[model samples]
Target chain A: MHPEPSRSLPEKAAPSLTGWGGSPAGPTTLLRPEKMRDFKPGESPQIARGMGRGYGDAAICGEGHTVLTERLDRMLSFDDETGVLRAEAGVSLADILTTFVPRGWFLPVTPGTKFCSLGGCLAADVHGKNHHVDGAFSQHVTSARIIPADGAERIISPDKNSDLFWATAGGMGLTGFITEVSLKLKKIETSWMAVKHTPTKDLDQTLDFLAIDDAENPYSVAWIDCLATGEKLGRSVVMNGRHAAIGEIPLRENNKLDGSFSKQKPMPFYLPSFVLNKFTVKAFNSLFNLRQGSRGEFVTKFDPYFYPLDGIKNWGRMYGKKGFVQHQCVLPHESARDGLRAILELVTESGRASFLAVLKKFGPEGRGMLSFPTGGYTLALDFANKPGLDEFHDRLDGIVLNAGGRVYLVKDSRMKADSLPYMYPRLDEFRKVLRQYDPSGKFASDLSRRLNIAGD
Target chain B: MPGIEGTALVLGATSPMARWTAYALARQGWDISLAGRDVQELRRIAADLILRTGATVSVREFQAEDLESHEGFWEDCVDQMEDLRCVVCAFGFMGSQDAQNEAPALAQQVMTINYTAAGTILMHAAKHFEEQKTGWIVGISSVAGERGRASNYVYGSAKAGFTQLLSGLRARLSKSGVSVLTVKPGFVDTAMTFGKDGVFLVADPKDVGGQIVEAMTKRKDVVYIPGFWRLIMFIIRSVPEKVFKKMKF
Candidate 1:
């Protein structure tokens, strides 16, 4: 066994990282063993972490040592024609996009953001706007190089270690730290998008439209007005799109110049804590809605339409000192409308305003045990961190639970520990697999503690 | 009579920080009013509080920019609240600094929104809280205000003004039972930070919200969310403007 970083023996630990949700409390020492040979059997750091992007505290190492695999980022191989990419767990989606998108390829599934590591994608079993057709990110994943607590780095897939494989999917990085991942990438003609925007009256219409037309589009999402009430509640504009064909491209210097889009600027500083009130948001939304509806049909560049939120530099500073919270939940198909309505109604009643409220339909269940998607409808609402926001979210959690839905663990901040099982039916199986790999009870996070997922 | 006995008003209550601060306070059993421009949305927020915390909470249509509506709204809020404990300002804007530099009008809009309107409302809130004497006023400030950088100077300048304003207000209010807490948060992960890359030590609104409540309950003077922001801003501010401007922050 290799010498421990600080302590000789493992301890009950929680792993913390700057994940998409929040930073969680984990163990103090984060050990990094360079190669698989360097890892000795039965000498684990208690827990392992990948590129920390499981939103909440799912990947945090609670009260024990953690093994960071960021240095393990490396490309193993690639299948040119099939666009099959096999890379180490540390490989970031951003890295993949920068390298592949320009080569006429894209991720089969991606979250709203693209900063996640491959291991994190598997841990959270992430999904994307195209989930209506392509399903979760795990659907594209063929296999992984997982290093279990026992210090064995082996390639795992559905065919081999299928139980452990599914467990790791949505497993929140519990089964092991994925060292490598092989995934299938979708081929595209060019870095252009053929998008069609449709403005809907409210949530009902938005849902109806999505149900009717979601099948036709590869990427679809609706931006809802969570603050709208009465007749206008859930008013939103849906943008649906597919990759543009090579022959359809119009010649433009900027578009054709480098065959890639320009990098977006970052918001640099915090604004004074008074500008983003209801008046401003309403006005902005009004203008935005008007623009969307007025534009009619136009084939614009892919970057702006698909990632408008990405254009702004350091936009978070706009929320001022306190920051904001995103309450995202996915309800099964049967309960989607009611779940959406209830959540929206709660937000409306609370008078909390959201600048961007996104709604999407997931295509299928991923192989990961704790993965987020399960053929359902997902909605994410962004709220500024005013006082009493937690109470508001807790009430939201109740509404989510009452509707037989659950908050996405990746995006949750206020969910009750007991409520997790209600959302994921296969919790017991996930726990069992986690324990099998980590019998020492290492590998924990504040989310796991808050939701009682692990560290019992 | 206008102020509730144990209630606090949250300006821009829907902002992530404001919401979190309010949540932090509510945990201590303090009644809260999640005030914002949308009356309908405020009421919903109030209902949500009632359901979650079982707190006697309510909401009102509060527009800081609409000076004319202030008196009546304050009066209405006072009538509903039992023990007006505090007023928290968690409002701000970060319009593109480049856009502001290009369009002088946009710069004015940024300053007016952050300094003029928000400051005026805070002054109004201070008067109420000061008169009550047994109240708290927590204003969410930012480290950017430490020293304006060209990257987002318009926004930074406005925040600087507000930060100074809060500091002065705190100095005056210290003697009174009314406590003023200034909160400076660094990077935060929200819709606003949707596309940001390589951001360091960013915080979540819920965490900040929890911290805000903790500060309020503890009655601290000034607190920094994610703590490291304090050190970060100190170092940033310490750098000479000549050197600071030369280096990309």
Candidate 2:
């Protein structure tokens, strides 16, 4: 039989796109699916994009179709009694938090940024500050509805299509386009957190403090002084917090929670590239440390604690027009100290100062095929995109691989193709599912093609 | 109206703008009756809005072309919500101007859906609000109603009449403490124009929803969505008839 000819498909108009990091993506054909029912996996290669909040090019498919799921967003159902919420894949974390936070419910797991979509979070298998206790975002997800290249919607859960579910949990949306997700939300007394600041000097104390001994405080994260050298190297101010009880806040009415969406200021335009340099970062880091250090034990809203960066709109533009690359890697507990120290040494020598470097402790390995978090300490550092950055990133990847650790794919823009299989041991299984779901390799992205990841 | 702050029956609640507005209203603590011809879509929107806002949301059968159903619908909304203080009529029909030029019947149907049916529903709502002596009647008119153009004069003409009717409704309903709002949105990115060619500067439903929330809270008589559409339409309305006829936009 002959293929259908002269069928008028959606026009392939070239449009320049970029991820949250502001890295330039080559022109691609964009499609906005207005409704969940309207999405179709046509003949052309395509990738589902929501909010385009991914730091890398995972959402972009250059010279191919890129389905925009922003319009497909709508809350499907939510059981107020059970706190089991179901919504379209395009719904943002900001929407969920804004609507549900005041209702005494919170996401089981949330990343630092709330602008990301449900599908994007699931695809990344994102881990939050609570990774030490709650694991990854996939663990909270009860079920998801995914449409493969064949356009058949399959509902996957831990018990149903378990292989596909686990593969898709961090499959980078290669298995299929997620249309809907049902997840359990944690009940909260208020949208406020009781926080304490503990100042740690040097890497050893910082690591020890990050272990978070107090069971009452489930969330712990450290903002390390990456630029510090000698005795001050790895000095950090650790913030430990837990949900604030009704009496924790000063409000007389215990039922009232502070779920305000205030303090929004736009960056307006890209700052000059030279604005963030060695001297500037050092000064900002010092100031930030002092600010954190001053706050001994206080009760604050969830936004400032979970998402301080979100207050400023277009905050990525502050990185400059060329954007910045964030390198985040995790090493097992045994090698964490040495591995993180080696990476920091490289950063110290590079002369490319990072304004902020974070360290967090993880509980155990997740079940997702390509889940980024494991039983380890993860170090995250952001560097302005400049000359010789690619080679430097490759060197850092080498150090991480040598330490038997892996880099977070969500934050990575330029990881080596060969290193992926080494880090994600279940890559073979994921590829098999991809082949079974999308046999013709119809689902692809710039990240997939560059990394030599196969869908068929 | 005595005990409840706001309870609305949203007609054509499945339309992009209306659906988003319903969610906004629910979030603002208004119990909503998501009434539309497509009850399936209405039910989904109602369920979604109820969950997000913790607002009482229910689906009802409301056909835009069914003018006879107006009386029973408003009564049913009041019965269900117990204190229906608002009726948001987001119903309109846009037809191809090219076809309207060729077929007179198509033009009449456009008038019937955009003008006749809407007025009947609003009239019933206005009477109910008049009896209660407190309510809101928000109508999402279009920027196309600002003036007639060759591109979509049929839609523009029908919308123009609808806008005029809303203006009259606003004046008459004011004495009874029933507020009326005319939302003239410019280019809106919606399912109707999903894959349409050559559309740009289309505002988001979320953004438009925010504007609707402001409108309801303030009870503005007439406003343009995105607010900028007001100026754009102002300039277009100010253009002389001779110049307007020559212009194609």
- The residue-by-residue lDDT of candidate 1 on A372-433, one tens digit each, is 77777788887777888878988888877887776787777677777888888889888888
TM-scores of the candidates in the order shown: 0.60, 0.90
Candidate with maximal DockQ: 2
Each prediction's whole-model lDDT (CA): 0.71, 0.83
Runs of candidate 1 with Cα error greater than 4 angstroms are A1-18, A21-52, A213-215, A253-261, B1-249
Candidate 2 predicts chain B with a TM-score of 0.94
* Cα lDDT over the full model 2: 0.83
Place model 2 in a CAPRI quality band.
acceptable
Residue-wise C-alpha lDDT for candidate 2, range B172-213, written one tens digit per residue: 989998899998888888754455565668888878877887
**Second chain TM-score per prediction?**
0.91, 0.94
The DockQ value obtained for model 1 is 0.01
